[model samples]
Target: MNRLFDKSIVLACCIAAAVGLAVDARLVAAFCLGVIATSLAEVAQGNRARRASETASYVYIIAAVFVPPFVPLAPLAFYDIARRVRREHAWVALGIGSVFAFALIADLRTDALTARTLLLTAILSVAATLLSLRTAQLEREQQRMRRTRDELQERALALEARNRDLADRQDYEVELATLAERARIAREIHDNVGHQLTRASLQTEALRVVHANEPRIAADFADVKRTVDEALQLVRASVHALNDNAVDLSVQLDCIVEGARSDGGPQVELEALAEHAPANVANCFAAVLREALSNAMRHAHAKTITVRCMEHPSFYQLIVTDDGADATPASSSNVAEGMGLASMRERVEALGGTFTAGPRVGAGGWRVFATVPKPQGDEDR
Candidate 1:
């Protein structure tokens, strides 16, 4: 848009100079040619192109001196130069206008210079200078507006990036809090409900043993023990649901085995093959492993323990074996199991699994084996 407007101004100046030269002498026509060339040069160069174009406007002012009719074109050239130059160099345009005024005054061939002629020249020169200064002011205002727009765009981009980062951090904090809450609930169930049920099972088992001679009383005690075992299984399932299994099952098993070894217990080894399991399944397995290891280390006086995990087509299995004294003979007969074994059994069975713990039939050690069916849809994955 600016380019087209500049070209129009240059064309108008050329037409005016051509008409003026046609009515004047040949010498005046030749001088007007110089004015046309300088004006064209000023128009051809862009605002930010080079400093060489600035000199063309000064040359135009000199050309206008020899031809009075071309003086009107001087203000246009001055305005162009002012728009391009800095405010500190603004005096250059006014100085060129002053030179044009002096040349006009001196060019009068009359014996005496009239006040009317002098005043007219001064007014024309002052108008051209003021026009150029106004152009320079508008240019400065435009530059300031452009700078402000660029700054606002950059600030908007920075603010958008900051908002995205803040949103991501907020989501992370919420997830951490949720996981912490789930872990707390799991701990509460284990420490409270699990402990109370374990004690009840033990007492019920003791009552069964004391009433063994009375068949009816023993059967009633057995029924009570069965009810307690069922309640324990439900509590374990709830605990397993509350636990978040973000950690891999294999990593958790390794930590458990390492902890037993660090405590100066029997030499413990773990071999976990199943990499992915449902959260509830993994939690039940962890509980069973912890209880089995404790029983082997504390009651059986095992010298070494081996923990192995296997993945089947429809189920996952965990086996913990220890080179320890035989399991209590009563464990095979269902004649009142200990708290550790009973708790392990309940946890595994609660997840629709089978659990067995006793002395390995031809071996001199105890082995606890559990097999839980994979959740629907997880068996294939």
Candidate 2:
């Protein structure tokens, strides 16, 4: 659009100069030079060049003063000034253009000063000013539309980023809820199902003892007890899985031991002796073993930890010893009890067991020993 307007302006100027040359060659030469200079100034680079271009508009006004035929060309300079310069400057250019039009009227020959010539020049000047103002308004509107579009695009991108963040948060929240539900189920199984299984196993063992004299019935009772024990093991495994813990006690203990080793703690020696032990004893042993190893690594700073599971004639025992300075033997009265030690004691004593944890008598480390009594007359044979 701008290119077409420029071409039209150049063409009109050439035609006007040609008409002026037909009337007077000397005056047309000056008008053509002024037109060329103004055109070059319009395309010149920088603020100074643009101001110089605006100043060049006066050359057209000067030419109009000498030749009445050049009066029409005054509007072209006014239009350029209005389009390129500030409104205040454009108003000044209009004033100058109006003055040049009157000057052309004053310079006109007596025969040329007709109402038709004066009316035509007035109409053309008004049209040029109005056209320039409309073009400026349109340019401002286009710029505003471009700004609005950019703002909308930026807002859309921001909204997309926020939505992605919200989705990620929702996924994390769902995963957390799932894990919490699994933990709740595991706790329920441990408290209710686990207790019932332990009780059933004890009752079956009691029945086998009562019917010992009757060989056939005693064997059947023994098989029932073994089945109950297997069920207890299965329940324990289910609970561990639900809680996302190691399924087997031995495996769990080995993992803890390896973790300690990897952390540059103690060289742990573990022995799982009581393979066919009841579920309750095995679970208790696992808890105690974990606490012992934790104490050995954290408190004792032990170089070596020996973990053993011993099954006696009528009991299940676990011994965990660590070779560290804090494990040096102290009297019961002198030993300072911590929550870990206290919790282990409470858990063991709850099941008719003896729980002792302190420095070993001869060894330069700590020792944790727990002995849980089995049902009377019951043995893992």
Candidate 3:
């Protein structure tokens, strides 16, 4: 809209300069040529077309000197030159000088160098050039402002996203601290109160034996022992639940490998734990891994062991392998079912899973593998 308004001002000035002038065939031809040059300059979009339009406009301006009827179109050439030069003040001055030179040549050729003619031609051309130059400068300033506004908007959005991430991290740290406190309380109850209760129950048992001849006293002591035993069982269950809820699969696996390494045993490595498993699955896998490590170190005299726990979309899998050579199943179809292995197999099968324990196919090591399928609602997990 601004560009159209600017061009309209130049056109109005051109018309004012041509007032009181007579219309003829030359004037109509000049107007048609001016429209053609403006169309090529404004509508076409290439360097070659712009150069062609500029060249044609200059030629038309020079030729119009002979035809006074072409006076209204001459200022359009100067306006276009100002627009092309944009902010180059020196080039705009040079263009105005060329206009005076063209007028002097006109005076040499014909007696058309009247003061009135020179004023209308030179003053109107200057007005059009000034208007075009100022309009170009305003357009460039507007474009720069738009680019700066867009960059600021992008930076604000990035800062907002960073703030959200920081808030989420703070919340996560608080949750971890709460879980750790619960686990610490559970451990304290198990270690301190649980042991005291066991000792009390044992003392009551010895008192019962000592008071066997007194029926009433033996019966009272027996009730006390039963109560103490019940309390101990409850404490153990509470500790187990607290520990299970507090520890995720990654931490449990880490503890398993690290505990084995710290026990003056062989080198143990926890290779991978891809995703978190459910509580029951995690507890089962931890148990299986502990049993496997014990068998490897004690029975097989393994020098190294590796463990992995992976959670798939439909199931959870645990793998334990050790560089042990004391696997004895050659005559029994590789079916050495001991109490530990049987316990591990039963735990897995109870959860609708499969278990395998034997020597590796092409290695001198025992491998224990278990996989438990997810429940119906958790299959997509």
Clashes of each: 0, 1, 0
For 1-381, candidate 1 gives per-residue lDDT tens digits of 443355465446434433423345643654465456445644565645446566666677777676565554555555556556666876776677677777667755541333443444455445544655665567678999998887786566445434543553465457557767988999998999899999999999999999999999999999999999999999899888778454477986788788778566688989999877765677678777876887788668998999998889899999999889986522232346754566667768878899998899888899999999987876677
Whole-model lDDT per candidate: 0.69, 0.69, 0.74
Candidate 1 residue runs with Cα over 4 Å from true position: 1-21, 24-48, 67-70, 86-95, 110-125, 245-381
Clashes of 2: 1
User: Over the full model, what C-alpha lDDT does candidate 3 score relative to the true structure?
Assistant: 0.74
What is the per-residue lDDT of model 3 for residues 56-105, given as tens digits with 9 covering 90 to 100?
76776767665666666677777776677534456644865576567655
* Top candidate (TM-score): 3
Which candidate comes out best when scored by lDDT? 3
lDDT for model 2 comes to: 0.69
Q: Give candidate 2 misplaced runs (Cα > 4 Å).
A: 6-46, 66-72, 88-91, 109-122, 205-218, 245-381
After best superposition, candidate 2 residue 7: deviation in angstroms? 6.4
lDDT-best of 1 and 3: 3
RMSD in Å for all candidates: 24.6, 22.5, 20.9
Give per-model TM-scores: 0.52, 0.52, 0.58
